[model samples]
Target: MLTNRRSTMPMKHVRMPSWHAGSKTTTSALPTYTIDNTPKSLTPAILTSTTQSLPGYTTTRLIGAIHGTASLTHKVPKSFMKSLSGSFTGSWGEPKPLTQVLYQARDQAIERMTKDAIEKGANAVIGLQIRETEVMGCIVVSVSATACLVEKERRGVKRDSAQENPF
Candidate 1:
């Protein structure tokens, strides 16, 4: 016959090693990242496009060539990596996470380029070229443009409109 025994010793707090601790994990909810299209250093007066000249403006003087570059790595946010894995299996649609990262990088590059042009005393940027490249699991955006001074073209008044305007 065996007799049950009990100990009167008080229990001490014990800590267990957590596998989840120290390991980066991604949750189902995507990270909130706001992309600001407008930059403090850039303004609407500064025109940018992939063309030789601005439509309603004339390039008076070509200041110089200005370039801006920005890059984002795959590991920027661990959540993106996880989302990317699952994103590949979905139907044809926009990749919100990846697109947001790219847009952020592009916007930053554009802002930098415009700032550079503004420093050079250029009112507008023409022949703008934006290139996107992937390097070593990173997305790189490069923007180049010819900074120039542009003046708005004056539209000649028609004969009827001119006669209507009495000086």
Candidate 2:
């Protein structure tokens, strides 16, 4: 029973549909998806039979790709934006020394992304991607990563550093 009126209607196409809108889906394991246009779904027809398992670490679950974004505007004073002193990295160009602004924006973006993952109980993030853009005198950065919990296989024992071996 769909309570939201918007959900009850036939959903408008948003990009290519990953799976049929009204079908019982089989992908009960995948938790996240990216906007990448990679080779289409891995159908059973092309299934590889020789899959080998790796060791040392086990992936307990996939929480999906969590994302965070930050935007900063270095409002350029009329003089700064129009003046020749800080404007232009080369001999000729338009507006302000942006190297520092870019750095700060990028760092803030990454910090937010990691904070998001931590808040969601992710031990680590993988497949990280950072994107940036400059628009209307503002710099915007966004970062995304696959957040998952990976547990390491325990060995025989872990000894404390201060413990002496009773040989």
Q: How many clashes show up per model?
A: 0, 0
In candidate 1, what are the lDDT values of residues 26-73, reduced to their tens digit? 443343454662222323347886888889786778999999999976
Model 2 TM-score, all chains together: 0.45
Where is model 1 more than 4 Å wrong at Cα?
1-45, 157-167
Q: Please state the error at residue 76 of candidate 1 in Å.
A: 2.9
On lDDT, the candidate that comes out on top is 1
- Over the full model, what C-alpha lDDT does candidate 2 score relative to the true structure? 0.55
Question: Residue 42 CA error for candidate 1 (Å)?
Answer: 11
**For candidate 2, what's the RMSD?**
20.9
